[model samples]
Each structure stands twice: as structure tokens, then as C-alpha cells.
Target: MSENGGRRSQAQRDAITVEIGYALFSGAFAAAVVFGAFAGPALLFELPGGLETLLLRTGLVVAPVLFVARVVSVLLRFRQSPQPSQPGRTSPDS
Candidate 1:
């Protein structure tokens, strides 16, 4: 029984670690995409006209602000959410 419990605990820890790893990877990927979308045109193509330069500059400024706002909103929603109760844990109010 003790060995089984230990195994379960270890599995839970491993799962949590995997989840955190995925979250980090996803965040990195999102950041890279955001950066690439805004910067790729400027770096990869020669701007033949002023309009293209203006558009790229505008996107570079606006995209990061929008992305940061979205991230903050999601974090706020997570913070406001109630956590699930563990199986053996009792609420203090109970």
C-alpha cells in the first residue's frame, strides 16, 4: 500500500512538471510567432514603398501591446477562479 501511494504521488508530481513544461513551451512559441509576424516583413523583404514601412512599424508597436493585454486578462481570470479542492482536504469554513 505504501509503495502504491508513493507511486501515485510521484506520478502526480511528474504530471505537474509536464504541464508546466508545456505551458512554458507554448508561451515561448506564442512570443516567437508574435515577434515573427511583426518583424518578418521588415527583415525579409525590401520595402519598396513608404506604405509598407509604415504598416510594419505600426504592427510592431501595436501587436505587443495587444498580446500583453490579452495575457494579463487571462492571468486575471485565472487568479479570480476558485481552485479545485483536493480529495482529502476539507474547507476551512466547513
Candidate 2:
């Protein structure tokens, strides 16, 4: 393959990786929200005993915190990424 072709392929792979990362993050956040919303109320009202209570309470606290951290990390990484050049414009680095 030609040099430019290789670069284009690499760029496509990178783009796909970023997209998958975003999708996974979105799924994680959604799961966290669903679990927290459903379980929080149930735990508050029903009051499970022993290990079940500990597990549910731990999940209630951990899931949202982890989701927020994942979001922040993704945002920071996204901000740090360079913008793609327009079709007609030469990249500044080139």
C-alpha cells in the first residue's frame, strides 16, 4: 500500500476507536442511571437486610461516581484531540 493510503487507513481506525469509546461510555452512563434510579428507590423503601443491603448501597454510590469520572475523562480526551482539516484546506502541521 502507498504511504497516504496507510495513513488514511490508520485515521479511519482511530476514528472508529473514538466512536466505539463514546458508545461504550454512553452505555455505561445509561446503565448507571437506570440502576441508580430503580435501585435507589427500592432500597430506600424496602430496606434489604445483611449483605444485600451493603451491596445495593455500595452500587448506589459507586455507579454514579464512576460514570461521572468516565464522562470527565472522555471530555478531557476529546478536548485534547486535534480538529480535522477541511477538504480544501491544507493542514497547518503539513
Q: Which stretches in model 1 have alpha-carbon errors above 4 Å?
A: 1-31, 87-94
lDDT of residue 20 for candidate 1: 55
- For residue 31, model 2's alpha carbon misses the true position, in angstroms, by 4.7
Error of 1 at 44 (Å): 0.4
> Which number leads on TM-score?
1
Badly placed stretches (over 4 Å) of model 2 are 1-48, 87-94
Which ten contiguous residues of candidate 1 have the minimum total lDDT? Answer: 1-10
lDDT of each: 0.64, 0.68
Residue pairs that clash (backbone atoms under 3 angstroms), model 1: none
RMSD vs true structure, all candidates: 7.8, 9.6
Per-residue lDDT for 1-94 in model 2, tens only? Answer: 3367545576657875786689567859775875776567666675557655766777777777667776677767766776575757878888
